[model samples]
Target: MIPEPDPALARSLADDLAAAGYTGARLRALWGVAADEAIGRGRALPARREAAATDSAVAILARLFFLGSPVRESEASAALTNVTIDGAERLGLVRMSSGSVTPSVMIRPQAYVDEHGAGEWWIASDIDESVRPGPLPEDHVLGVGGASLTLAGLQLPTSAARVLDLGSGCGIQSLRARRDSPDVTATDISEAALRFTRLNAQLNAVDGIRTLRGSLFDPVQGEVFDRIVSNPPFVITPRGADVPAYEYRDGGLTGDALVCHIVMGAGVHLVPGGIAQLLGNWEYVDGEDGLHRVRDWIAASPVPLDAWVIERDRMDPIAYAELWIRDGGTVPGTDEFETMLAAWLDDFEARGVREVGFGYILLRRRTEGSPALLRFERVEGAIGPNAALGMHLAESLRAHDRQARLSDAELAEAVLLVAGDVTEARHYLPGAEDPSVIELRQGGGFGRTLAVDPALAALVGASDGDLPVGRLIAAIAELLEVDPDALLSDLLPRVRGLLDDGFLTFAGGEASPSA
Candidate 1:
């Protein structure tokens, strides 16, 4: 048997690992390689370390890289016997177990460090072992994953004095917030998760991250926040009354319970002019509007809040069942797999869940008493991730409120200025004698095109916002010698469409009559 690990020795090893290029990107790469090898080889364990000299940093990484492959606890212990697994455990480098000893070791990457090179090691072993209990080994670390990064990038840029991260798994979102905010308090249901959050905060060299252990806002009662963020465990599962310890994925409530609670409770916790960002899923009940459901939650809150809810993607009941069933590592063609799938479908159908909608939800507390709901949906583009769009949406909502308070007469007096590089084009029909098409084109970003109706085109060209839209239509009819009523009927709808599409907005200095 290997000798018991010493705490001092483990600290030394951790310091050395930190000195080497073992943290952040390097650690992620190593973990990725190890995961790939395990998945490809189907091996429960890899080769033991050969008692070679650890002179070169690359040599050590190579040894650890090979040793990191998913395996039985005994196999990993035997392989890295010289490294003192217990010592590494004490230093938060590896999580080891003797029972069922294949390889229960989980290596954590250091949280902070800028560059990727030798002697900048930042990886750490995952410490939240009690939260998730299972044989599947890859779900160990609290490293930055896709969903964590997604929610992080989606946060508004304004700095807050106090920020709250609810259900802060692994504390990734809290770390991001602490980079800008003065204080961050992260809450979770698991004590072990809180410990990991504290460790992760230290690893990132970020200070003042307080960890609270409780479900949602229990620990933060009577406290209001400047901003709140949560990537809650909103997955809908069939294990009614028998919730698993998978606190990271199971919210313990059935059919959008967690999301409703978060949405309803966020307003109470947000101070005036505060904001909250959340990523969650809501089940689709037949004939019910998911957007309206969220709207009602906002309406019920005492705090007046503005909300932007986007439904990114929807999955049908069968598709949803299959996807999550496979996620549990159950291979199809097996009895266990079929039974789990049946249970999922049955649960979904019994609850009348036709589909499930997933996306990002952003809420901001209005100043004192101006509550409004703005709901829109956009299919994610293929170009890149939609994280940046969330901030843009927030900015737009802020601008919209400013625009809404303007009076119609003030809107008429406003100059209709266009964005940079906007150009007008006239395309005439071939030889048939009709006038050419007058189109407005914006040459940047999505390159939006607007085809102007001939009569409306004349009105826009002459618009200094000096005349009301109805008078402008009348003036155009007189100038072109057309029927005034006929022109008004044709131009109104087209002009409204242009305004709706963002081709027109009031210019600065155009004060509303009400103002």
Candidate 2:
């Protein structure tokens, strides 16, 4: 009988690997020798008997190495399995139902940290050569990738007793949360992903990262979280098809279905006053507003929430369709590639999707009667500290709420002073002198320049929070010698826009949205 492998033996191998300069390519070479030895003898190799052998093997593979390469798998089976194929099967070293040993079944490695090193080692899926490969292994660990780190850093810093990392692929976000929060629960649809998360947590020296296997929100029923973070599969897939094996990229939904569903359901899972922050994409319909769609979803929600939605970037349908197709490794000239691309465009067009917009969404639960703030604005770049633009928005929301209870005269008395650091400028025509243009420019914080009509400019100048807006407009009309009706008609919209953009603020209580 083959001896059971010792976990310590794996650690020794990893140490030797570090000493031997075992880059990924060199590790594969060593793995081939090991596999050849086992296959040539046609028998199951005994479990590692000596620390030296394990060390020697690991010294050649290194901690940064991933052992799932096909060449390495072949080598591992040949070196580690018994010469007698049947003996290998009896030991659970290889599945014997198939006449020949399959690398997937026969070549399994026990990942471990190098004895002298600090980071953890993990086993991952062997790169698949198949067209439509099976889902990732139940314990399939992953290499560090950009998106994983992005989500980790983007999470809001809050100490919560309980936190949830939904769609926790490779467990990177979960690990970060566990480091910051007292308790963390991670969930994913793939069993392999869950297993990988567990292994990764252990590797990273993080304990208490609970792993659950289920779709988003399904695994955490009846549980409320102080903070919930997700980097879910937001890519809208074609209809009637299972997405590729990369669970990290595919949400298994068609045309913004996943985003809408998640946003609509998130409120139910959050504790009163809890925050839900997520990265998502929405399809922009030709006639319907994208912001309005998200607003409608939140409005239909059974729970009350204050929401902030920012559209960071948008791509035309054709460009969006082709981007994901290429990401899936579809070659443009191939027939299969053409079919997939065509399908994506057809579906998008059928749904009236003209553009795909990506953004960050933040929602907070509020008390009854709190007005929900739904904002849709175009941002210049990626979401990060550079996008710290949202910080002022929180203050703005509070100000608006305070402004709501004031009387019309009190509102009129509210003087609109430009924020500190804002400068007012007047631009004159080159030759013909009509009314000079009045512009307000701000150097920072939601940078914008607005062209103020002469009447509105005079009213804004006169506003000292003493008179109501209606009387102020009337006074400004009298002073400017213009028709009050025409001035009000032209200036009302401009004033509202300025308020919305944070250029102007009411003097007294906070400013609320106009009905």
Give TM-scores for every candidate, taking all chains together and pairing residue i with residue i.
0.70, 0.59
| Residue 103, model 1, lDDT | 30
Name the regions of candidate 2 deviating beyond 4 angstroms.
1-147, 241-246, 369-371, 382-515
Best by the lDDT measure: 1
lDDT of 2 by residue, 465-493 (tens): 56666777888888888887777667665
Query: Which parts of model 1 are misplaced by more than 4 Å?
Result: 1-18, 23-67, 70-87, 95-142, 241-245, 369-371, 376-380, 412-515
* lDDT value, candidate 1, whole model: 0.61
- Candidate 2 at 190: error in angstroms? 0.8
Question: lDDT per model, in order?
Answer: 0.61, 0.59
Q: Give the worst 10-residue stretch by lDDT in candidate 1.
A: 112-121
lDDT string for model 1 (342-372, tens) is 8888888888888898888888777744535
Residue-level error in angstroms, candidate 1, position 500: 9.9
CA lDDT for candidate 2: 0.59
| Per-residue lDDT value at 269 in model 2 | 89
